[model samples]
Each structure stands twice: as structure tokens, then as C-alpha cells.
Target: MADHAGHCSSSSQDRRSHFLVAAYGYQGHLNPALALARRLARPHGGGARVTLSVAASAHARMFPSSPPGQLVVAPPDAEVSDGIISYVPYSDGFDFGARPRTAADRARRRRVSAASLSAIVRRLAAAGRPVTCVVSALLLPAADVAVEHGIPLAVFWNQSAATLAAYYHYFHGHEHLVAAAAAAYVGGADDPASVTLPGLPPLRVRDLPSFLVDATGGEHARASIDSMRALLEIVGREKPMVLVNTIDMLEPEAVALRAMRQQHLEVFAVGPMLPRLQLLQQTDAAGDDEGRRIDLYEQDDEKGYTEWLDARPRRSVVYVSYGSMLGYSRQQVQEMLRGLRECRRPYLWVVPRDGRDGDVERCLMEMDDDDGDGERGMVMEWCDQLKVLAHPSTGCFVTHCGWNSMLEALVFGVPMVAVPNWSDQPVNAHLVEELGVGVRAERDAAGLLVGTELAKFIAVVTGDGDEGMNIRNRASFWNQIL
Candidate 1:
């Protein structure tokens, strides 16, 4: 194996190839699917041939160089709609105000959920296998297409299975269990700090991540819930191979019970998906001298972040982002910038473009009051986020706690300050703080993050090793779990 250490094929080491409907306008949805694509492509040691047939144009961008690669671009025939499920070719990716994502936009993004199953069916007809296996994000045409083709289709739950189980239980007239808990703790507010399901252990509302908490407050939440419930119903009655992006050990009980009821459960524990999958592949290919090809997502950007990092100082900066879906009001955006500037911390913030016609760069500078360190607060319209976080100068992450970012922060053993806006964010933030890996921010009774609270949290993360290192130590311990 040493003779051919670096060379590898993109043929997917798995003995069997599988098709994946990998398409999403936003980064959060797109990144995990890419991670799963990478995982499936690597050899599973049993000579199982696995090739991920991603079904979309945006997805094609992710695997541009990787092989056994096929991207089923959105055909012109498929139309777009405002309320219906369809893909509107977003020449420009989704953008919210220089703030967090709004509820309606979140719903619209999820609504543009066209499953290009027709494309996949045709592809198989041309050259691929019988198309027996498929994984999807529970979109409309997903199961219908799979059924038409007589293929076994699995609704890949991108969120935690625990979250799915909660939704299932919620539909069974047991959702109040959470409403009651939220009422009891956060006082009828959507911000339920801790939630416990009947006959199940106590799961923090934060641990459930943000969406479950905020769904009650917004319109997108309803559409997404409808989608999730429909998905769970399909999984509930007829078991399609369910693929969840969580760990067996971390969420052992939930995983166990999910498999108990469902006949076809293949819980990969394959998460923190990007890095954990890499770990498994690296371990499996430990001493193999075979030629292996490079994975595309890990490829360097034009300028290269590592090179950028080398020019910056050690642990001297803060990272800020509201994730891909979350948007903020212009008012909230101002408060956030004021907080960052007041904190006196040099930061790299992903300032959101104003909704429709907003300018991203102008927003960042306007957010700066003092400009004490001109450009000390670097603003990137869109970033190679993973690479930026891995930079040594990055001391803390002020994030929306998307599953991908949570895993990325942990992989780098980087400390974080949490400000969960929506979806699973609240849950992610709670886990980040509760795990001792990241510090938490205090929000008011109305759930708005106080400016001082944001600044204070930032100071703690960028603070000295005595405190920050302690958080990093806890973060490193979790990294070991991966």
C-alpha cells in the first residue's frame, strides 16, 4: 500500500452503487448530502460498490472532479412555484437581510423541493444498475418515483432521529408534552429550554435543536412540519432504509428504538458526517497501498484558506455567521454588529445580504462603529466556511449551529459561542453550551439576544486559555468521539 500511498479512485470503494437525490439551494441542506456522498463513495471494506447518483445541478458543482459521478441537472420542463414544491433556478443563492433568515423564506426554500426522480429513472434506464436503492430528503416525488421504479427508497432524515421521533409522537396527539414543557420552563414561549418525551428521557429543547422550538412561531415551520410528518408517516408504515446523520453511542436509545419499530434501519452513526466519515475511511484504508482518488469537497479554493490562515495571528479572531437559512431583521443586524464592535474582538463575519436588493459588503462596514482596526473585522459575502474555521487565527465560532458547523467546530477542537436563531439551532446551541464545548448566550423573555449578552459570550470564547482552553479541552474530548 505504501507504494501507492496518495493515488485513489473516485469509483466509490463500496461494492454496490446507490443513487442519492442530492439537491438543495442552501448550504446547510447541500453540505450534509455532499458529506454523505463522500462517505458512500469510499470503500466499505466489504467490496460493496457504492456510487452516489446525485440528482441536481447545484450538486454537480460539489462533485465536479470526483468520478462514478453523475449530476441530474434540473430539466427545463420542471416548473417553479411560490407555494408549491418545485425548483426555481436561483441564479443567485438564497440571501436574507444582513441579518438572519425569515420564517417565510425558510418555508419557500423547503417548498422548492422537487425530487428529480424522473432524471434518476432515466439514468438507470441508460447505463446504471436496476436502481434498487435510493436516499432522499423526503421530498414529494421521492417515494413515488422509487415506487414507480420498484426500488427500495429511504427517506434520509438530515435532522436527528430523536427529532423525528418527537414529531411522530407529536402527531399522535402527544405534541403537548413538549408544549407543556416549553410552557413550564420558558413560560409558554417557543424557547423551551429542556423537553422530555413520555416514556423517554429528558431531552433539552436546545438539544432537540432550534426548529422544534420555533416551528410553533412561524409559517415555514408548518410547511416543514407537514413535510417531516409526511416523511415519518411513510417511514412509520412501510420501512424504507432510514439513514440518519447522528451517532449510535451519543443517541443510543433513540437509535435503538427507531430500529426496533422499523424493519430496515441502517443508522450509520456516520456523522458529524464530514469528518467522522473521513475517520472511518482513513482507518479502513490504514495500510492499503492502493491508488485512491481525492474527494472534491476537500479541494482548495482559488485563493486557499490555509495560505490565508498562515498570514493571521494565533487565536486572535472571532468567527460570525447566522448559518444558511436563518435571517435577521435590519434592526437585529445592527445590534449584532454593534455588539461585535464593542466587544473589541477582531472577527470574520458572514454578513447576510439584505433581502432582494441588499448589499453585503456595505452592511459589514456600516456595522462597524469605531473601525479601530480597519478591516480587522473582515467580512466575506460567501466563504469557504470549513476552511475558514480550520484557520489557526479562528479562536471562536459565533454560529447558527447547523449540524455541519457544529461538527466542523468540534473537529477542529475550536471553542464556540452560541446564538441559535431557528430550526435546529436552538437545540444545537444548547448542546454546544451544555456539552461544555461552547458558551451560551442569554436571550430575553421575548427570545431576542441582548446585545451585551452577545458581547459577553464573545469575550468568554476569545478570553484567555484558563477559561477558553477548558472549553477547548471539552471540545477536544468530543472530537475524540468522532
Candidate 2:
């Protein structure tokens, strides 16, 4: 392996080399990538010139003042040091316009983004800030550009190390078993079979990522799986390092299997790269001074939820969020509302409004409280998730079990009632159960979360019973380590 430091320091210019970290524009992918970029550009020393890049539309949504197809350094924020790190936008075929609503549009955006990224790299190199390493967030095409320019590319696996290992094994040799298990699970309807991967525990067919084999998974899901397979193939052939957002202790067996079937494979567990606030508070540091959070959606004031939480009893509030992209059907949304209303617990739910679907809004209007003070439950488009998780009043989390949200729940020692939507969430939910940190709620035949089941699971995890206490203790143990 070539030493990266050798390329970083040149005789003519004795400065830190550049690291260009690119995320795929979704909130889940961008947050971890941004945290990693911040680490690379840490103020004191032993840091690099980090420039974070994302799709043009996402960049526009993040910074509305900036125009698309232009590369401009981010204006300095008081909390973020200016020169240490910067953000730039590149064309992803959506020039600050409406987001892509179809698979063909998404595919075109990916192709154009690849070309635009290559141009960005060339321009950066020409300007004397050659990128020493290109870190990509699950986007394989970016790696081709890096290879073309003879620069090392590192994949920042945004999901858990265990999930990555499962995907790798599936591509390497376990396809038949996984596919059969998925089919059996889909066929069984009531009681499904389990798929036993090489390094992980037995996962129910429902727990498998939808992209791998689920027939109902749409084009986007299929495209994601296809892209992931291509990514692993690139890793297998080119042998670039894989950097997973996980810790070794959390998934020892999975981490051990990181290089089981692939040659020249090197994997590093360098994460739980949470936001600045969560990181500081969890580390017992005094700084509560919040910095700019890498959120794509419009967010409410961070203090509102924390103040509301402060008034509640310890471990009494349920924090609910379904991530940035996943959307629920009208039936599903209504069921969740009914569950929260009947659960009789104070809750804070971040339900992002979907412009395409009026059902969510209709349901919200139907369930609006007469008092309008949000006396029992509060719903907003967005909230500071990390701050809410860290609050002492946050007892349980009702989450989609996306890797980032799952990690936040575990790190904060909050028990979970997981309602996994799709794509690696099932695996993450299973891991949560296996680790004894949380419990998975049962879904109906149509995979809709039942109001009764949601209430039952929430009560199970938040109740004052031995099982709940045990789960809480296990969560706390992990949080302490984190």
C-alpha cells in the first residue's frame, strides 16, 4: 500500500493535501459525510484541507442563496471556521430545480453528477489544491474519476459494518440462500423463514434489505441495490479501502468477516460520527454551543423540543422520526397517529410534510387537538434529532431504524420501538434486538404498523418491568462506551 502522507506533502508547497468528501445528497448520507469532513479538517493540527461536495439540488436546498452549476466557497458561519473546511456544489443534472421524481431522472442525475465531479476534480487540481483522497458516500461512479486521476478513493459506508459485510457476502456467494429466504418469507405471509448469512445471526426474510430480493421494492430500491453491487465489485477489483460508519466493539463478528471473501480488502470502522452537539455532550465535555447541523429539511428552533422535554418526567417522552426520504401510505400514517394518540404518552414526532401526498396533511387536520397547544403530542417537519436524543426526558425512540438514527438511539441509551421501512433498516432493527438495545414492533400482513402493536411495543420498552429495565441497562452500557 502506498503511504498517503507521501503524496500530501510536496517539496514546492508544504501544506496539508486536500480531501474531497462527497455525499449522495440525502440527509442520512450527508450528515455522516459532513462529520467525517469536519474531523479531517479539525482545527489544531494533523488535519487536511477538506472540501465537502454534494448534488446541485441538495446543495441549493442546503444553501438557497447559492446558484447551481457554480463552485463557490461557503460563507463563514460563526460556529464553523472558514478556511479549515469549505462546501462546493456541482451539477447533478438538477439545477436547483424540482427533485427527481422518477427512476430515469435519478439515473440521469447520477451520470451527470459523475461527469460534473470529474470536472470539479480537474479544476481543483489545476488550482493547486489536488485532492489527495476522494471519499464518496455509497456512490460508485465517483471512484472511477478518482482512479482515472490516479488518486485513492475511500468508500464511506454510511450503514453499519455488519450490513456491508452482509451485502459483500451476498455478492460473493450467498445469493441463492438469500433469494430463497426472501421468496419464502414473501410467500409465507404469516410466518416467514429466516436467512442465515455467513457472519451474522439468523435474519428473518422481512429483515433482509428490500433491494436484495423483495419484489414489491420499486425502481429506486432496485437502482440502489444495483449501484451497491457495482460498488462492491469496484472494491473487489480495484481494492480501494472501505471506511464503515461503525465501531469494532459494537459488531465484532461482522468486523472480523470484513475481508472474508474478497482479496486485498481493507475495512476500517471509524465512526458513530454524530453531530457536534451530541459528540461533545456524550464525551462529558461542557460545550453545548451548537454548530451548523447538516440538515436538508427546514428545521425548527432547537430549543423548543429541549424546553418541552425539560418539563416532562425523566424517560417519559417518545421521540419519533421516519428519516428524511421514507414516506408512509395514508393508512400507515393514520395508524401511526392513532397509535400515538392511544399510547397516552407525551411524544414528539418529526413528520415531514410531503407535497406530492395530501393524505398526510388531511390526516393531520383530522387529528388536530382542539386546544392546539400540542398538549399530548407535537408534530413538526423537522427537529434537532441529536439534541432530542440526548435529552434526559427522551425515554424511547420510535424510529425507521436507519443506521444513523439507530446509532443515535443507542449512543444516547434510549430504548427503541423500531418500525423499519426498508433497505438495511430491517437488518439494523434486527441488530438492535440482538444487541438487546431495543425491540421490533410487529407489522401487519400488508406491512403496515398496527396501532395496537405500536402501543404494545412502546409500553414493552418504556414500562417499569424487568425486560424494559434490562434493555435500558444494555443501552446505557453502550452509551457509556460511546
Candidate 3:
């Protein structure tokens, strides 16, 4: 293995390099890649020219240039799954925190488009920083470019490793099983049933997200899944590595799964990266604070939900968000709105307005409950999530169980109500429920939200229920430097 440090050159005459990251235009993908780009672009000693190439329109807003690293627009060819960040402000809780939905045809067209990656790379090459390593974020075109340039490629798991492993296994000749299990998964109309993977422990059919298999009953899904499978299978052929954006302690199963498959595919769990990234931002905040405030939000929303915690008691508000990319049905969204209304508890909900479909403001106005206690609710399209989790006023979290959101919850030691939307959320939800950090909620077909389940969820989150709290408390305390 070649030491990466050996690639680090000090001579100013030598052309500098940029960590070319493919973020695929979603918050989940772009956010992490941006953080990494920022990390790599940071100077070690005194002087070093650097660049951090990002692929989002919001980059200029969120990451203003005091550090002066490069912020490239996500190009056309860079388009992975979907090409555009919908006008839908990437809100939380609404559609399980996903970017707004678009037609499959447009998505397919965008996926095959060749405008972004090459242009960005060409720009970097033009900027005197020949692109070095390529990092792909599912849709981000890093892998394709990596193959083109013969540079090392690292596929970033924007979600959790558990789902990554499951999807990886899907491509490794589990097509029939995936197809069958996917049918059963699509059969959400029936009673929830368990389906087992060959190398995995038993999991419910509902545990698998529909997107992992061929939902179209066509080659695109199969080919896409197969492509990902082929990518994972042969990643080690060139001693390529897989980077799981979680800490070792957060998910042992994902870590174990990676080890089982191959040795050359090294798994480095260097996160929960956002927290560390935020911590780094704070470290750098003392002087350059004025120019680089975190941007990319409605002006008023700069005030975070957790800021309320400054006055309230510790762990008081239930912080709720479903990450930035989990899709949800309309019924599910309404259920959460109504359930929170009934729960009568103070909460902070990152509910994105339907930027395209309808007036999200209408949805908010319609769900208006005169609970009277300003404490009962705080809703927004998006929130500065980490600040909310880290706030002392946050007592509990209700989430769709995206690994990033889940780990952030756990890292902050907040108790949880886990709603496994799709992907590895089921596994993470079970881990949380079984381990005592959180509890799962029941759902119905159409995937609509249920209040009775929400009642149980509320009880569990509020400490009015059973043994779950003991686990959460221990986890919380463990996080307190113990």
C-alpha cells in the first residue's frame, strides 16, 4: 500500500491538488463530501495552496470563502441518480428528508448526463490542480471519472454501512433473492414479514427499501444495482478502499460486514464526520467568524431550534428530523404532523415545505394546533441539525433512522423514536431499540403514520414508558466523557 502522505509534496513549484468529490447534488451526499474537501484543503503547517471542489448551488451560501478553497458547481456529467437539487429546499421530516421528487424519465436523463464531472475536473486541471483522487457519493460521478483517469476511487456511504453491505450483497448474485425479497418488500400491503439474506441475519421484508432491488421490473434497476454490486465486488482489485462515514463504535455490524467481504477494501470509519467537522469549524471560528457563518437557509432560520435549549432545562425539547434524503408518503407526513399535534409535547420538527407540489405553508396552517405553549412546536424546512442535537434543551429525537441522523442522535445521547423509512434504517432502528438508545414505531400500508404507535413512541421518548430509557440514559451518560 502506498502511503498517501508520500503523495503530499511541499514544493510550491509542484502543481497543487484538489480532492475531487462527487456529491450528486443532495444534502446527504454533498454535505459530507464538502466536509471532507474542506478537511483535505486545510493547511497542515504554514503555507499550502489548496482547493475543495463541491457540487451544489448552495455551496457559495453555506461555505463563503475566507479559506479561499475552490467551490465548483455540480456539472451535468457529474449527475449520478438525479441531476438537480429540486427547488424543494431539501427540508427535513416531510418526505423523510429527501430532495423533492421528480419524474423517473428526468432522473434517468440526468443520471446519464455528462456535463458536471468532466467540466469540474477540466476546471480543476485548468486551475493548475490536476484532479487527484475521485470520491463518489452514490450519484456523484467520482467513480466514473476515477475509472477514466485511473486514480483511486472511494465510494462514500451517505447513509449507513449496514445498508451498504446489504446492497453490496444484492449485486453479488443475490438477484433472485433480491427480486423476490423486493417483491415482498413491495408487498407492503400484507402483514409485515421477515426476509433473510444469505450472509445476513433475518430481517423483515419491510426492512428492505424498495429502491435496492429492481422496482421497475426492468434492466435499469437491475443494471444500476448490478453496477453498484460490480463496483463493490471489484473495488479491492486495485486495492481500492471503501469509506464508511461513521465511527467504529456507532455500527459494529457494518464494520464487521466490510471485513467479511475482502481485506483490500479497507473500511475507515472516521465519523460521525459532521460533528467533528463542526468542531473543526468552531476551532476556526475565533477570528474568521464574520465571513464564514453557515449559510444556505432562509434568513430567519439562522436561529437554530436548539437555541431554545439555552433557557429551557436540559433534554427538554424532542428534536425531530428525518435526515435530508429519506422519502416519505404524504400520509406518513400528515401522520407525523397530527401525531405531534396530539402528543402536546414541545418539539422541534424540521418539516420541509413542498417546494413543488403544494404550499407547505398551507400544510402548516392546516395542522395548526392551538397548544398555546410556544414550547409545543418549532417547524422549519431545514434546521442546523447538529446544533439542535448538541443543545442541552434537546431531550429526545424522532427520526426516520438514517444512519447520519441516528448517529448524531446517539453521539449526543438523545433518546429516540425510530421510524425505519428505508435502507439500513431498519437495522439501525433495531439496534437502537434493542440496545436501549431508541424504540421503533408501528406503521401501516400506504406507509401512513399511526397515532397509537405515535402514542407509544411519545411515551417511550418522554420517559413515561418502559425499559428503553435505561438504555438511552446509559448511552447518554456514556457520551458525557465517562
For every model shown, the clashing-pair count is 33, 0, 12
What is the C-alpha lDDT profile of model 1 across 149-218, one tens digit per residue? 6666666667665665566666656677766665565554454435665324567655554445563666
lDDT per residue as tens, model 3, 236-272: 4544556677655555655667443554455565455
Highest-scoring model, lDDT? 2
Model 3 residue runs over 4 Å out of place are 1-18, 42-50, 60-115, 182-200, 213-239, 258-263, 276-295, 302-307, 325-334, 355-360, 366-369, 373-375, 464-466, 477-482
* lDDT, residue 89, model 1: 25
Candidate with more favorable, higher TM-score: 1 or 2: 2
| Alpha-carbon deviation at 151 in model 3, angstroms | 2.1
lDDT head-to-head 2 vs 3, winner: 2
TM-score of every prediction relative to native: 0.74, 0.89, 0.76
* Number of the top TM-score candidate: 2
In terms of TM-score, which candidate is stronger, 1 or 3? 3
lDDT of 2 by residue, 1-482 (tens): 12332233332222466778888777888888877777766643245788888776677677655564454433221112355577777677766555777878878877887887898888788888888888878876687677777787788889988789779888988999988777766676543546777777667677777678767767777777878888888887777777788888988888766355345577777778775444556444653322445777778666776678898999889899988777767798788877887778998988785522787777766666531677777777898788888888999999999999999888788899988878899889988988999899988867889998898889889888999999999999988988
- Minimum summed lDDT over a 10-residue window in model 1 is located at 1-10
Candidate 1 has an lDDT of 0.56
Model 3, CA-based lDDT: 0.56
